[model samples]
Target: MNLSNSLDKIKTFKKVGQVADNLGMETYVVGGFVRDILLKRPCKDLDFVCIGDGIKLAKAVADALEGKPQISIFKNFGTAMIKMDEWELEFVGARKESYQNHSRKPKVEAGTLAEDQERRDFTINALGIGLNANNFGELLDPYDGVKDLKRKIIRTPTDPDITFSDDPLRMMRAIRFAAQLKFDIEANTFDGIINNAHRMSIISGERTIVELNKIIMTDKPSYGFKLLFVSGLLKEFFPEMVALQGVDSVGDKSHKDNFYHTLQVLDNVASRSDSLWLRWAAIMHDIAKPPTKRFNQKVGWTFHGHEDKGARMVPGIFRRLKLPMDERMKYVQKLVKLHLRPIALVNDKVTDAAVRRLLFEAGDDVDDLMQLCRADVTSKNNNKVKRFLANFDKVELKLQEVEEKDQVRNFQPPVTGDEIMAIFGLKPSRVVGDLKEEIKEAILEGHIQNNKNEALELMYKLAAKKGIVNNPDK
Candidate 1:
């Protein structure tokens, strides 16, 4: 397992080795960097664990670099970091940690390299590449991390229960790594996660969401989400999503399970685009189905107005999960509200007016919205899925045509309220607003062309009806 050639290729490794030798302290590149190296994955950040003062080694390495990169030292944690060009080097003292019953934060004490590796969350992550002069390029696998890597399994360095109980966030990391690497979680480790699922309550929402976002950003995010759902980790942080689970039957009629449907939509979106927010829209598009669900003998099952309800639910969910309250949140809300519009227009006799309205409402997000709608077609009926997809292609063509002709996506009226006020020689009043809405509705409805001349003429006619003067100059 000697990575002597690999170590030689990285000049910084030699520089750090030289610095550590000068300082007379043993150092090794540890954790993710080591794991990724063996996995042949591209990784830039290096975590070095030194048997002596990590801060001192970090300062020495920084000083030895070209720019004398600024070393950021954390005295409380016995760690330091430096950014060398695009590379981030984090240095930490070799230490063992003991966690309390209520907190994930562990009490740290200086220890050997083995102790540092023992504290790692996963065996695959505990692998290390020695950088000390004597053991340079040597591989340390005290936990048989190489075997876990070879088997493509996610397992903790020690007892699964103790590993997870110490930091419940590791449970989320386990699922994330499994999903990202396409690896299987060991049976005992999976059981340990289920047993310690409730312990995640001790983790803060902020910390939990970091892992959640990573899971969402993976190639097939739904895999991680399904893991989270089965492990009961999702219920701990997002009960709203949990509520979307299962289906109720009445008189031999039942709706598809919204939870699994959501996951399918998420996977579909993942296959099409890598936008995290788009995937989020898929997850949330049907979230209010539970509350809005109804069963009628004639209608079977209906989630009336769930879109509006789901849109309303987004803000609260974002607030609860500590997600961004900015435009990203607004984007998800907007998509949820309009998720049904494109589908509704997919039938025969689809009109340009409807496409124009969708274009106007969806604006720059029209493409993403269309992607989501296509992804939403998760029916088991192959013919139905084919029909919906063909219809969506038509819808997309209609959108393109309407956008090119009418130019109504995110349309502001050819005439503004202020322009209307000026044309009619009026102050700020309801009449002005009425006139602006009229022109916008006219363009979106295909009643009038999207042009200033057509809009001006219509404005003049409306002004006359309102008994306002059409004075160009007062």
Candidate 2:
């Protein structure tokens, strides 16, 4: 395979090639850039590998670019980075690696291009496009990477066991690539992953989560998750999700497998939105069903309060997974807590009051919540699915009408603490809080209109009932 086309895209790359030739070093554009170029995929970030000093080549390339780009050198790793134009270009010296029994970090030594290919995690990533003048445009594919790329397969450049055992993070990367590219993992490589899944224990939660987030961000994220569950990778990182898998039966009746159901929901949400955490909320929406599962002779099986329980589990799950424990964590928690609200509207009468409360609680996320609820309806029966969908349409329309009329989303009570305090001439106390709650509930429940005057009047009545005198100034 020749890669003159890949080199042709970047004019500055030619200068580096000339500089490398002058310096007596063999340098090639290697790894993902080469793979993506042959696959006709768009990639801006480029990785270059050289047989000699990478820092020298990186400095040369930067210098060739009129010397303005910032070149960061890492002497310990024989690598350098430059943020040129729109992409990050990293240069590294070709090296061999030998890992320890207890750690993924390897003992590195200067080596040839073959050594670099051998160290690559996947065959597709081992392909390199030579930039040296003599072999310019020639693509080195010692591992048949182009063939594997053509077949849309995921296989390591070296033996799967050696690749994964050297760095267990490669296992996660393999699954992430397979999911993102919609490719099949080679049988031997997948088996090696399963065999070495336990080795992931040596990896840190932070490092593991980086690949986990990539898997979640894919178009069909559930595929990667299912692979993780089946191969026991998820159990090591997220036991809570794996716990949602099995079905519990009693007296000839069983509940839907919440684990697979969660995956279906995750896929459904992914089909509509690209938000990673919202998709996470879909995956964890029923995580507590197993603990809350119940069986009765009449109903067969039920998961009561699973939503509330799952919401409670969200903080713990985020903490364990190394996910953000701030607003993002709260966003997911909010979605999990309210996942069932819209669905509960489907089977029963879709009411304006119910929709208003949902809009009020969900606020700007009302649409995402509705999407999650609709995706939550994963019934196999055609009629049930159709019925739920039709009912959801009605619920959505009602929500729009209610939101437009009441403006209750992210609603602040028309009556403020100052107003309540002024009206009742009372200091900060339970009475003020009680009055605010009363005013907000009145607006939400439609007992009184969502207006300042109406709220003030309602506040007065409550204060009168509570035996508080009105402020003479008002």
What are the per-residue Cα lDDT tens digits for candidate 2 across 397-468? 778888889889999998889878887677899989999998888888889989889998888798889898
TM-score of 1: 0.96
Error of 1 at 224 (Å): 0.8
For each candidate, how many residue pairs have backbone atoms clashing (under 3 Å)?
0, 1
Q: Considering summed lDDT, which 10 consecutive residues are worst modelled in model 1?
A: 417-426
Task: Summarize candidate 1's per-residue lDDT along 225-286 as a digit string, tens digits.
Answer: 99999999999999999999998998899999999999999999999888989989999999
Top lDDT prediction, candidate number: 1
Off by over 4 Å in 2: 346-351, 422-425, 470-474
- Report the Cα RMSD per candidate: 1.8, 1.9
lDDT of each: 0.91, 0.88
Looking at model 2, which ten-residue stretch has the lowest summed lDDT? 343-352
After superposition, candidate 1 runs with Cα above 4 Å error? 470-473
